[model samples]
Target chain A: MTTFRQFMSSSSLSTVKDAGTSAIDSLKKAKSDPSKPPRYSAAGLLVKGAKSEEWPRVWREHDLKKSYDVVIIGGGVHGLATAYYLATNHGITNVAVLDKAYLGSGGSGRNTAIVRSNYLTPEGVAFYDRSLSLYNTMSSDLNLNVMFSERGHMTLAHTDSALRTMRWRAEVNKLQNINSSVIDPQEVKKLAPSLDVSPNTRYPIQGALYHPPGGTIRHDAVVWGYARGADHRGVEMHQQTEVLDIMVEGGEGPDGKGRGGKVTGVKTNRGDISAPIVVNCTAGWATLISDMAGVKLPINTHPLQAAVTEPVKVFLPTVVVSGSLHVYVSQTDRGELVFGASVDPFATYSMKGSLEFTEELAGHVLELMPNIGRMRLLRQWAGLCDMTPDYSPVMGFTPVEGFLCDVGWGTYGFKAGPVSGEQMAECIATQAVPKLIAPFELARFERGDLVGEKGAAAVGH
Target chain B: MFGTRSFSFSFERSALMMLVPCPHCGPRNNSDLRYVGESHARPDPNAVTPEEWRAYLYWEDNPAGSLRETWYCRAGCRQYFTVTRNTATNEFENHPLPGNKTGAVDPSFHYVSSSVSPSVPTTSNAAQETETNS
Candidate 1:
């Protein structure tokens, strides 16, 4: 089930380690260098960094582009995060974050923020676990409570093959020192308590795959924290600055210029702004932005939707996932039940929620937890997702000079807000892309070396 | 073990004389999830001769007694599970087997191999972390 990181208490996180009893030490260990890496059973280790400042009123400016060392296109979490990481980690001062809309108003804001490290592939489990580890201490490091919850994550399997696949995944997770286990029907009842797993069904509650270090996070705080940090480090954040057309002078290799002149810059609604470096963090609109630069991106623009229900007494304590059901649900901090499902079958730019989705979601959720039938939905909305065939984000450099991309995050971009931004910043400052982000390069798709993250990326939690 | 050919088992004939291993979810009342008589299994791939191939393909035994056959829970579990069905009575029962229990039914009603695991820990917690599911 799709869930918000609303109820991932620190106490629940402590359960995976020395048995979830005390998290004070874990929290402390997270803030400083531990004798051992932050002992996260999720998937990877956690490293805490300092909190950054906010970009106040950066969203309302209608002014055009100003010159900068690096100008990142897209003011969402990834753009802001890229700015924050560039300023704090790399110390490259003159950076600008441009957004077409208000900050965090895109997929980054509309997503159901659940973070977990339970992945089937080694590369996947390792990468996401690192992000989960960072999230644990992100609030403190950023000096804000991003509400890093480590409640736990569960993947319920109905069929025996599905259950066996769960078992296989659990074993692989354990081999990496990631905590995951097999649970039977009785255990499933104890974890969710409200799940309907009558063994008499076709796909009975044979087992579940559990990750103790899995949980949720606050999506807005992540955007805010990075923006604040980047702003503090003298990064100019320009919101509502829509790039109308990109002017790339035709040239040879990275030295091409248009109209027999050197490369100029982008013409935004506000005015023309020239910059050497432009990072496409436009997210769902990434393809459009890339096309402006005369580059064809390996991404398809698709819309993903999520919804919330009127706040009720908080009943969901942990994040739940049903791969078979294709429905993931969790209750938010203020008691609103958050629901998310796979992207609609068709790809469009519209954000209108559909009734067909509501019917399908209600049916699946009711089957899992029959008791919540009394609740009513509060609202539903959709966001654009630049999807890739392999389901991995398109990061790193492009064929165009000074143009970088942090787009094509699919639906899992929200939870990876901090990490992706942090890494993108490093790439910008050093002018050297990190190898970790190397696997997700646009070149991978062309070369067929794509790092397939479909196993861990389907649910954006 | 997963990429092999087809399997066989005792199939219960419904009131309409349908078979047992048809693909109907338990709740679907009107679906033809079964067929009358028993499903057949192929001979060992290691065996030689056209006769062996024919025997594995179309041969059958009429031991309508406690018949032991290969059962594929396609619609239900989508996994290969062992089951003992009374040939004469056409009753179905499921049992776990070690490795690939292709035809070990007549001699053994229980899990007869050493590979049936009690608690082999995997990386991803099969969610059944507690003892109740065991």
Candidate 2:
């Protein structure tokens, strides 16, 4: 029997009143009936002759419902993961994920996909380690190939101050049981010989912070996998449905001036959804979403630009980052050199690629590998980043009741997607903030307790 | 240092430069300048809640289009000035003319000095006394 039918059979008594017995039986037949197409697999690939364009659809489309248990905004990694965990972990399948555009069209698809846990702060290190752990088993858990590559990651330091900060990060990572350490220029050159580690360069390479368990993954696959898993568990996925505004009923909160408000529902382009609990999981447009609920955020939206070079020989084995240059480079399995830089100086919603960005990117890349200067860039693109002060994300419950935010992701949201989903699901299911993400509450800023991650996050992600 | 290779063939002329008007030295490329963050007003410390204080310290307007922001000309006559630039197009709508609030010496924004000489004194009493005597 399918997992959905098994769940239906186990929980039939409770759901019989709200969801009719006939409806449940029909849904079960839709999943378990032999007429349904087979699932994708290596053996199934051969049986279908590999050109299986006629195969089963990865996920089913559904009509919009008038109400749901939970309404999640932005069908990106965080939103989909939360819905997936809510169904599989908490047995809450009455969820709706709404997105203005197609899933993963935002930062989930734009990031360089470098995953690491070598952060400077203890809170950051612990949080990212949990994310890395979840990513390690995601393929098996989701029954989809996420293609997580744990090759390694190295952050090169070109100045004395940069090297000192790398040492600090290494120590913090060590306390968390993460495999991180500082290595000299000679060792860095040995690991990635393409790097120009010679002292004759404009900014000589001092050393690098190396983490053995850090590497890159296929970002798009992660998005699709989570979406498929969530859909399989009966979470409704709504695309091209933009949330116009969030409806909040007034009440008393921490600051008595209209702070304590309850989330009634959301006004979307499709129609109004009367959901008791609403979550803001959008990264780039987080501030705008929060404002709809009358909750202001300390977020600035900036365009973070990135580019990919034409397929070269697979040369870069590890993810390499240069803090001094504000650039990170990684080689995909398909052999394209992916490059990402820090967020643009000013806050803007426009995703227009700047010539200044391309010029500076080429200069920085050439500084690291002078031999590859001739390689042409295939195309350049930009994605919006919701930057927060202290460079940490805002997660958990807000002052508004029933309204939660998992935003201010800035540049590293893609790396923390799975863990954020798991924790946010727990927060929503239990009506209490999990301890793992308690320090990241929105009220922490009001309490003068900020988890500062700027020293480590100022560079490329 | 950036390369000297000509970019004449790659892109349009307007996109090549982020024209930052320097009060002391006319218009210059944004690469010749440094970006100071949003010029937000700090709240009085003695009479506010942590929430209000944090809002002052952290929150930003961060508009999508035109907004007034502060920038420093590091390559030219090192001075700080404010100008309105469209965050979307990265184009300067207002120029940084002379006698405009050239608060380069403003005590509130001592960027280099703040990092160089930290608020806390590092020298001991003996060294302080010796320096006083000298």
Candidate 3:
């Protein structure tokens, strides 16, 4: 059913949008309309995509040729996603996906799993919007359930300046045909009915930029589904096969293009594998791989943290983010509350979770949801984010011929995985950058073309 | 230009000595931030002695006048703000150095806050100017 707040925001009634009618009407329309054919979730696809249950976790050259048409580095979600898109979309089946560890064992598994498109910059908003739309049907498209949830996401504004930014954002989102709007205090109250909105406050939450279309999903499902689907399409998956360095010799290495400085193949632990193209999909370690190829990027690495609580009665039905509070929390299907926060000031490669972060988040979240003060936090974890100053990912062709760049995923990488892979593959196969992928070039930094997205990307859910 | 800082050259400072704040950060003693009272005065580049130039870089008169000057909040705020302190009674007004438009009042915006005219003293200048005018 259309949420009451959504009906109120729908303006067909008389004037501009009203919160109550828009919320209710949207909910009602959704209820009346039937959903399309269901997509295969990752779990569902696991049974159908794999051969029973016994693919060796780590496969080496002893079993296969240890070589292929294309070699993708890093087995993390981005790398696998790139591999999946190449195989399924581009018909490049001679591709091999390699990871230092297990699939989805990196940042992808460590995220809060929240997804949204309520971004500030047009470049950012448009890019993320496309990803969200793709994720909406990722399950059906892959014939597996990634358990894609379409609940809702909200970003609360705590100051007049922040509220003004929300209004500005609402206008920008409308320009992009997105469903985000600047909600008032009353509307925010209805959406998160149990929140404490005290007026006598520091950083008082005056309103929010409500994105009813945004929500959280399962992170692990993305890795499994992509891997299984890619494998089914004749792509090889290799785990624990750390690529030490890439070997590019005589005339532009593999894919055979650039100043005869081609990449011949990668020097991996198992053995030497020759590939026509080597796509780097490593997130935190993208710069390392780039250096191996003599390609430099504007990418720097920073780690982001997230935590979850044990199952509680379903107190939260939507994702909540207080940008001012710098805290976000949501109740998972298992009744556990998943929480995530922004990256710390400095950059580091360490994955060790910090006690200070959890304590800060708990204090902020407790201020909003006072009743949930007694709940105990179960586990906390950290993930490395390949953050760019502009908060946008870099994709498509680089200075190197056979070496394509898809680094700089950062925390938003999980939500953009499928779309990122699809576009990067298109860029490679077409020999021309896709319109959607062209704006995120690694060279945009030097040319003074920064898409500042800090205002819209906090807690990421 | 978030990391950008600006420097301003005053046409009035050479003729009438000026008072400016210490750019360095210091303690609660306030005086821990010393002022180089009447240095930076310039004769034409060719006319002055190297010692005269040295004195410009090192000396002071902290003279009194309708003199342009710099003022520092040596006691309270640690910011390096400049002000015009009348040397007569050590009575002076403070203003940020110019060209840093975003942080300083724009002579161009003389229209909006007419209450703060170009002729008026800054917050630091207001009391002393009021006392002098009285």
Query: Root-mean-square deviation of each candidate, in angstroms?
Result: 20.9, 13.0, 19.8
Please give, for residues A142-241, the per-residue lDDT of candidate 1 as tens digits. 6556887788888887777678778878887898889899888788788888788786654456778888898878888888777666665677777767
> Residues B1-134, candidate 1, lDDT per residue (tens digit)?
32122112122111111124222222121112321122345457686565555334322232323344443444554433233444323333332233423322333332112231111111221221111000
| CAPRI verdict (incorrect, acceptable, medium, high) for model 3 | incorrect
Best by DockQ: 2
Candidate that scores best on TM-score: 2
After superposing candidate 2, which stretches have Cα over 4 Å from the reference? A1-38, A50-53, A251-258, A458-461, B1-17, B21-27, B44-51, B65-68, B73-134
Ranking by lDDT: 2, 3, 1
**Chain A alone, TM-score per model:** 0.82, 0.91, 0.84
Candidate 1 is graded, for docking, as incorrect
TM for every model, in the order presented, reads 0.65, 0.82, 0.67
Clashes of each: 55, 0, 59
The DockQ-derived docking category for candidate 2 is incorrect
Q: Quote model 3's iRMS.
A: 24.7
The docking quality of candidate 1, as DockQ, is: 0.01
Ranking by DockQ: 2, 3, 1
Candidate 1, superposed: residue stretches over 4 Å from native: A1-65, A201-203, A251-264, A459-461, B1-134
